[model samples]
Target: MIISQQLDTKTDHQVQAIPLDSIAQAQGTNIPFEVCVDHANFVRPNPQKHVNRLRSDNHYQGLSSQEILNLPPWKDDFFYFSYYAGLNGTGFMGFEAGLWSLSNSQSKSHDKCVDKFIENHRQDQRNPMTQLWIFNHKLKQIQWKNNKYIFILEYRGKGFQVINYRKTAWDLAQDQTVWFEFVDTKGNRLGGCTEGWTCPIRKK
Candidate 1:
């Protein structure tokens, strides 16, 4: 886009062209996350519209050690409580930092699974509602192989599943450190996830 300018040196030249980038740079537009690559956008593009209430374009690079540590807990995925990331060091952003997604964050995932299974189970001889999780977890690391340490996962929610989960899993300390690699449960990228799938942490 060109701007209109009035000049006396020429025969009434009314249009002037100026680079938008030049204007933008002159203004010293602040980059998001205080991160940049030599005044150039280093952040890899993503399909998601926003992260941390900011336009993704602001910061083109990855998260710094301090930045990752400061992520809000309420934003943590899972049914509600909290499931924060286990970030260490400056790393790539988004999936490039590893599958890094909480399938629960998808919101509709639970509904989709329950609805489909309920519809199918309604046809059974005995009336019952059923839903199953099939290898939904997509863990980037395998911690169970070495068997040097033990890892536990706990979930709290309604229904029979809660009973099982409670017996098998309970509350870990608040502000507990959990290493995770969120993945695309939508099947966009597969590590162990296909639609309706979740990544699992292999703990010994």
Candidate 2:
């Protein structure tokens, strides 16, 4: 999906469309869940108890590991929500268990919304939240001005982690198009596509 943001330029604010692919490419392999999980494990040996409590919660009972990993499309909301729990320092298993609970708790309409949002972006990835997890990690700052057309994002970090961006990033590269600006966290224009850029968006 193209993320449009209202950037504060030298003269004034300009609306820019940041293709999601560009952002993914900039952030190489800094996967949030992997990092968060490792941090949690090193900080606490018995992190499983929290995970167990999450599993016992109404949202996540009787789910297999595979089920959590391969959550249904309708459960996308829960999947993304679990990222925050991980961001708050939950381990990989803790995140998975929380996701399992959330997936079971959401209604049909919520799942339909998830499906529609993905289709609207023409995003082909079966699990969009995986990419979102990465996006959330690099997203240093973001805000929506008046509407969707006006957005601002301050991304930090490098290298592509999401495979879904391959085709789009390739198309941009082959055509030699400059879709967005690559800047530091301070909003300095480093260059266009010559370098790399990152964009983060909330699923609507």
Measured by lDDT, the strongest candidate is 2
> Model 1 misses residue 91 by how many Å?
26
What is candidate 2's TM-score against the reference?
0.23
Candidate 2, run of 10 with poorest lDDT: 36-45
> What is candidate 2's lDDT per residue for 1-204, written digit by digit as tens?
111112222221112223333222232222222111101101111235434543564555776544544433212211122122222332343343232222221212223333434463465443333222222223333222221111122332211111112222232345443233334456554333221222322332
List residue ranges in candidate 2 displaced over 4 A.
Answer: 1-46, 54-113, 121-131, 135-204
Candidate 1, poorest ten consecutive residues by summed lDDT? 159-168
How does candidate 1 fare on TM-score? 0.18
Residue runs of model 1 more than 4 Å from their true location after superposition = 1-49, 52-106, 111-164, 168-204
lDDT tens digits, residues 79-109, model 1?
2112112222111222222123322222132
Candidate lDDT values, in order? 0.23, 0.28
How far does residue 114 in candidate 1 sit from its true spot (Å)? 10
